[model samples]
Target: MRIVLATTLAVAFAVPAVAAAPARPARLGLCAACHGETGMAQIPGAPNLAGQQLDYLREALRQYRDGRRNVPLMRAAIGPVSEADLDALARWYSAQMPQTQGTP
Candidate 1:
């Protein structure tokens, strides 16, 4: 019966891990690809996000997430993020120093 006991323990431990696996940080890799690591986007047509107003940035993300603003790539990028993550990103980007002074 030792084998049965060990199997039961293994499953009991594994269930929590499996349930917790999906709690990863909201994936922002796509944003970096276009928007750059610091929000100074390099890809064509990607807007610079550094030092943007907090409210504006937050609103844009909210719109994209909810389909209120339908920029296909942006919608796709933010598609899986939660509202909390959107706020976090807005705060991060808004805190960046603008590439030029007297901006944002």
Candidate 2:
């Protein structure tokens, strides 16, 4: 009984702390200028970020940050983003439903 009780208490305390921090909002203010308010793009060249694969987005950001992909504007945009922020942003957009082409 004591073991079960202790285990229950431990699990309860452990889970919430991990769950508490929200990975930025679905609409990020900085991303909004090009990626639109909801991961959709309003800019001419920016691709829609909504519903992209998490791994793909993360890799792209990593590339941009590491200079493997050399689009000057993207490198500039990602320069200030930390690895954690990049992961958060990737998760944020990956969970969104993709907008259909020409739907707007």
Candidate 3:
């Protein structure tokens, strides 16, 4: 009986743990299509995102999300992203090491 009670308690505690995995970023594939796998923008006119400030990135995304900034492409690109996804993307991009090439 004691063992059964202990097992039930353990399972109860473990349930929340199993359910608590961090939510994966949505729109990450769209982000990667232009930003590259590491957040370095590969397309011309796409701003480099690697190592950018989190606050700045978040603000920019917010602007795009809210129609404050007027880039149609960017607005469309960022439209579907959630706040948590923006935060996660900003955090992920800010940690990348930026590389620079000579100006063409």
Candidate 4:
């Protein structure tokens, strides 16, 4: 009985941790078209997002979503994003390792 109780408790605690792990945003491919999959910018004039402050990334996404930023492409891409998905994107981009040019 004690073993059963312990196992149940362990599973209960483990479940939330598993669920809390960040998921890849559904719109990642769209973002990746401009910003590389690891947050490096692939196109000219696009800013690199990797290693940016978490709060900054999150806020920038929010601004783009709410129309404050005013860039047509960003506004279009961020328009249909849900709050959870936005947060997930921010987390993903912010957690990436940044690559610098001319570095071996």
In the range 77-99, model 2's lDDT, one tens digit per residue, is 77867877888888888877787
Best by TM-score: 4
lDDT of 3 at 68: 91
Per-prediction TM-score to the true structure, in the order listed = 0.67, 0.69, 0.69, 0.74
**Candidate 3, lDDT over the whole model:** 0.79
Candidate 4 residue-wise lDDT, 9-99, digit = tens: 9999999977865667777999999999889999999999988888998999999999989999899988878888888899889878898
The residue pairs that clash in candidate 4, if any, are: none
Stretches off by above 4 angstroms in model 2 are 1-22, 25-27, 101-104
- Residues 1-104, candidate 3, lDDT per residue (tens digit)? 99999999999999996675334465578888898757778798777887888799888888888899998988888887788888888776766668885789
The collision pairs in model 3 are none
- Which prediction has more favorable lDDT, 1 or 2? 2
The better candidate by TM-score, 1 or 4, is 4
lDDT for 64 in candidate 4 is 94
- How far residue 84's Cα lies from its native spot in candidate 2, in Å, is 0.8
On residues 27-79, what C-alpha lDDT tens digit does candidate 1 reach at each position?
55677788766778878788898789989988999899999997888888898
The candidate with the higher lDDT, 2 or 4, is 4
- Looking at candidate 4, what is the lDDT of residue 51? 88
